[model samples]
Target: MKRLWGTECAPAWRAWLDRATEQIFRHPDCGAVERELLDHLEDKATDLMRIFPGLTREEAEQRALEEMGAAEELGEELARVHSPLVGELWQLTRFLIRAVLVVLAVECLWLLWKFA
Candidate 1:
């Protein structure tokens, strides 16, 4: 499974979180929701690292994941409260637009390199 947005180094925990919350991305308030989730994770990681100064970023991330509860259960709960059918389509469109821009940027860079 792919890592969660902020858990790039903690694949073990990230896989669980990513699988659980994959559907939440379609929620209308996805930007707010994602920001909240990342903030929570950051706080948890900071606390873990403070307690164990020697802990690596990955280790802190795993500890934070453990405290955050199972991703599937949490995802279900959040989806129930937040997901909107029409909003899903809107969210998807926004994501696609962003992705296309990124691809265009990469292609432009590649072309510039070739022509230079």
Candidate 2:
């Protein structure tokens, strides 16, 4: 089960948090992901802080794994909401343009109906 995680559960939690943090790099506007990651880090850090006295980073991360769930689980949860556009900015831009067009069309229709 631990091998199913990563290098080690100790490093794995940090790596998972880093990966989640990287999601912010991809979508800086994702408040939800950022909040979740921060909360997860804080909770795990506190748990580690409580369990082992003077815990190092490794010890903290390991304790985090026990309380915070697996990296795979975190990844899966993020994947559910991660609309990672990556280098597909063009597609995202196009989608935005289409959405704006629809809104404009709706507004135009509303104005015409009101005037008539």
Candidate of highest TM-score: 1
On lDDT, the leading prediction is 1
Question: Model 1, 94: alpha-carbon shift in Å?
Answer: 19
After TM-score superposition, the amount by which residue 62's alpha carbon in candidate 2 deviates from its true location, in angstroms, is 2.3
**Per-residue lDDT value at 5 in model 1:** 44
Residue-level lDDT of model 2, residues 49-79, one tens digit each, is 8877789876676666566666556656666
List candidate 2 stretches off by more than 4 Å.
1-14, 18-26, 29-35, 51-54, 82-116
lDDT, model 1: 0.72
Worst 10 residues of 2 by lDDT: 1-10
Error of 2 at 45 (Å): 1.7
Name the runs in model 1 displaced over 4 angstroms.
1-14, 25-27, 85-116
Question: Which residue pairs of candidate 2 clash?
Answer: none
Please give the CA lDDT of all the candidate structures: 0.72, 0.60
